[model samples]
Target: MTDSVYVHMAEYLANPGIIGLAQSPGDLVITEFMANPAAVLDSDGEYVEFYNNTGSAIDINGFTLRDDGTNSHTISN
Candidate 1:
Protein backbone atom coordinates (compact mmCIF):
# COMPACT_ATOMS: atom_id res chain seq x y z
CA MET A 1 0.00 0.00 0.00
CA THR A 2 2.99 2.28 -0.33
CA ASP A 3 1.65 3.82 -3.46
CA SER A 4 2.02 7.44 -4.47
CA VAL A 5 -1.61 8.52 -4.40
CA TYR A 6 -3.00 11.97 -4.84
CA VAL A 7 -6.45 13.42 -4.43
CA HIS A 8 -6.53 16.70 -6.34
CA MET A 9 -2.76 17.05 -5.81
CA ALA A 10 -3.10 16.39 -2.12
CA GLU A 11 -1.40 13.37 -0.58
CA TYR A 12 -4.28 11.09 0.36
CA LEU A 13 -2.17 8.25 1.69
CA ALA A 14 -2.61 7.28 5.28
CA ASN A 15 -0.02 9.28 7.20
CA PRO A 16 0.34 7.10 10.28
CA GLY A 17 2.50 9.86 11.81
CA ILE A 18 5.10 8.90 14.46
CA ILE A 19 4.07 5.61 16.03
CA GLY A 20 3.50 3.93 12.64
CA LEU A 21 -0.05 2.98 13.49
CA ALA A 22 -1.89 2.53 10.25
CA GLN A 23 -4.91 4.67 9.41
CA SER A 24 -8.28 3.44 8.15
CA PRO A 25 -8.21 2.71 4.47
CA GLY A 26 -4.47 2.26 4.44
CA ASP A 27 -5.09 -1.08 6.06
CA LEU A 28 -6.07 -2.40 2.67
CA VAL A 29 -2.92 -4.03 1.38
CA ILE A 30 -1.94 -5.53 -1.89
CA THR A 31 -2.12 -9.26 -1.40
CA GLU A 32 -1.11 -10.69 -4.76
CA PHE A 33 -0.33 -10.00 -8.36
CA MET A 34 -0.59 -12.33 -11.31
CA ALA A 35 1.85 -12.38 -14.16
CA ASN A 36 2.09 -15.03 -16.84
CA PRO A 37 3.46 -15.44 -20.31
CA ALA A 38 0.76 -15.97 -22.88
CA ALA A 39 1.12 -17.08 -26.45
CA VAL A 40 -0.44 -13.89 -27.76
CA LEU A 41 -0.47 -10.71 -25.66
CA ASP A 42 2.32 -11.09 -23.12
CA SER A 43 0.43 -9.15 -20.51
CA ASP A 44 -2.95 -10.72 -21.10
CA GLY A 45 -2.96 -12.57 -17.82
CA GLU A 46 -1.71 -9.83 -15.54
CA TYR A 47 -3.80 -8.88 -12.52
CA VAL A 48 -3.52 -7.47 -9.01
CA GLU A 49 -5.30 -8.29 -5.81
CA PHE A 50 -5.85 -6.32 -2.61
CA TYR A 51 -7.18 -7.19 0.79
CA ASN A 52 -8.89 -4.85 3.22
CA ASN A 53 -7.95 -5.46 6.80
CA THR A 54 -10.72 -3.29 8.12
CA GLY A 55 -14.37 -3.88 7.41
CA SER A 56 -14.87 -0.45 5.99
CA ALA A 57 -15.47 0.93 2.55
CA ILE A 58 -12.73 2.88 0.79
CA ASP A 59 -13.20 5.56 -1.79
CA ILE A 60 -10.57 5.29 -4.50
CA ASN A 61 -12.37 7.31 -7.12
CA GLY A 62 -9.30 9.07 -8.48
CA PHE A 63 -6.49 6.90 -7.35
CA THR A 64 -3.64 6.13 -9.68
CA LEU A 65 -1.65 2.93 -9.99
CA ARG A 66 1.92 3.54 -11.13
CA ASP A 67 4.55 0.92 -10.91
CA ASP A 68 7.22 -0.19 -13.43
CA GLY A 69 8.24 3.47 -13.95
CA THR A 70 6.85 3.62 -17.49
CA ASN A 71 3.20 2.67 -17.34
CA SER A 72 0.48 4.11 -15.13
CA HIS A 73 -3.28 3.96 -14.80
CA THR A 74 -5.67 6.17 -12.90
CA ILE A 75 -8.79 4.56 -11.49
CA SER A 76 -11.99 6.22 -12.72
CA ASN A 77 -14.55 4.13 -10.94
Candidate 2:
Protein backbone atom coordinates (compact mmCIF):
# COMPACT_ATOMS: atom_id res chain seq x y z
CA MET A 1 0.00 0.00 0.00
CA THR A 2 1.36 3.38 -0.99
CA ASP A 3 -0.66 5.15 1.70
CA SER A 4 -3.45 5.88 -0.81
CA VAL A 5 -7.15 4.98 -0.84
CA TYR A 6 -10.25 4.85 -3.07
CA VAL A 7 -13.92 5.23 -2.19
CA HIS A 8 -16.82 4.15 -4.42
CA MET A 9 -20.32 5.25 -3.60
CA ALA A 10 -23.27 2.91 -4.02
CA GLU A 11 -25.77 3.38 -6.83
CA TYR A 12 -28.15 5.45 -4.71
CA LEU A 13 -25.93 8.58 -4.62
CA ALA A 14 -25.16 8.87 -8.25
CA ASN A 15 -26.75 10.72 -11.14
CA PRO A 16 -27.02 7.52 -13.19
CA GLY A 17 -27.80 5.49 -10.06
CA ILE A 18 -24.83 3.13 -10.07
CA ILE A 19 -21.84 2.38 -7.94
CA GLY A 20 -18.59 4.15 -8.78
CA LEU A 21 -15.00 3.06 -8.16
CA ALA A 22 -12.71 5.99 -7.48
CA GLN A 23 -9.12 5.21 -6.59
CA SER A 24 -7.00 7.31 -4.29
CA PRO A 25 -4.16 7.16 -1.79
CA GLY A 26 -4.12 4.75 1.11
CA ASP A 27 -2.99 7.20 3.78
CA LEU A 28 -5.94 9.45 3.04
CA VAL A 29 -8.40 6.59 2.75
CA ILE A 30 -11.16 6.09 5.27
CA THR A 31 -10.96 2.86 7.25
CA GLU A 32 -14.71 2.56 7.79
CA PHE A 33 -17.31 3.33 5.12
CA MET A 34 -20.84 2.50 4.02
CA ALA A 35 -22.48 0.99 0.97
CA ASN A 36 -25.46 2.43 -0.89
CA PRO A 37 -28.83 2.41 0.79
CA ALA A 38 -29.96 -0.32 -1.55
CA ALA A 39 -27.22 -2.61 -0.34
CA VAL A 40 -27.31 -1.63 3.32
CA LEU A 41 -30.28 -2.50 5.50
CA ASP A 42 -31.75 -0.34 8.25
CA SER A 43 -31.03 -1.90 11.62
CA ASP A 44 -31.81 -5.35 10.26
CA GLY A 45 -28.38 -6.98 9.97
CA GLU A 46 -25.55 -6.57 12.44
CA TYR A 47 -22.75 -6.61 9.93
CA VAL A 48 -21.36 -4.23 7.29
CA GLU A 49 -18.78 -4.74 4.59
CA PHE A 50 -15.55 -2.80 5.15
CA TYR A 51 -13.98 -2.56 1.76
CA ASN A 52 -10.24 -2.20 1.40
CA ASN A 53 -10.00 0.37 -1.39
CA THR A 54 -6.30 0.89 -1.07
CA GLY A 55 -5.78 -0.73 -4.48
CA SER A 56 -3.68 -3.22 -2.54
CA ALA A 57 -4.03 -5.54 0.41
CA ILE A 58 -4.65 -4.01 3.82
CA ASP A 59 -4.40 -5.39 7.34
CA ILE A 60 -7.28 -4.23 9.55
CA ASN A 61 -6.39 -5.78 12.86
CA GLY A 62 -7.33 -2.94 15.24
CA PHE A 63 -9.92 -1.22 13.09
CA THR A 64 -13.41 -0.23 14.17
CA LEU A 65 -16.78 -0.41 12.44
CA ARG A 66 -19.70 1.64 13.65
CA ASP A 67 -23.24 2.07 12.37
CA ASP A 68 -24.96 4.42 14.85
CA GLY A 69 -21.86 6.62 15.24
CA THR A 70 -21.34 5.52 18.85
CA ASN A 71 -21.12 1.78 19.26
CA SER A 72 -18.14 0.39 17.39
CA HIS A 73 -17.15 -3.19 16.61
CA THR A 74 -13.73 -4.46 15.69
CA ILE A 75 -12.85 -6.77 12.80
CA SER A 76 -9.81 -8.93 12.12
CA ASN A 77 -7.40 -8.34 9.28
- lDDT leader: 1
Which candidate should be chosen as best, given TM-score against the real structure? 1
Position 53, candidate 1: lDDT: 77
lDDT tens string, model 2, 3-54? 2223333332343322233334442255444433465557444335455654
Reference-based TM-score of each model: 0.55, 0.33
Model 2 CA deviation exceeding 4 Å by range: 1-44, 67-70
lDDT for 3 (candidate 1): 36
Off by over 4 Å in 1: 1-26, 35-44
Model 1: how far residue 24 lies from native, Å: 5.1
Instruction: Write the residue-wise lDDT of candidate 1 on 1-77 in tens digits.
Output: 45342223123544323232225555767677654446457776776676767666655555566664446656676
Question: All predictions: root-mean-square deviation over Cα?
Answer: 7.2, 14.6
Candidate 1, residue 14: how far the Cα is off, in Å: 11
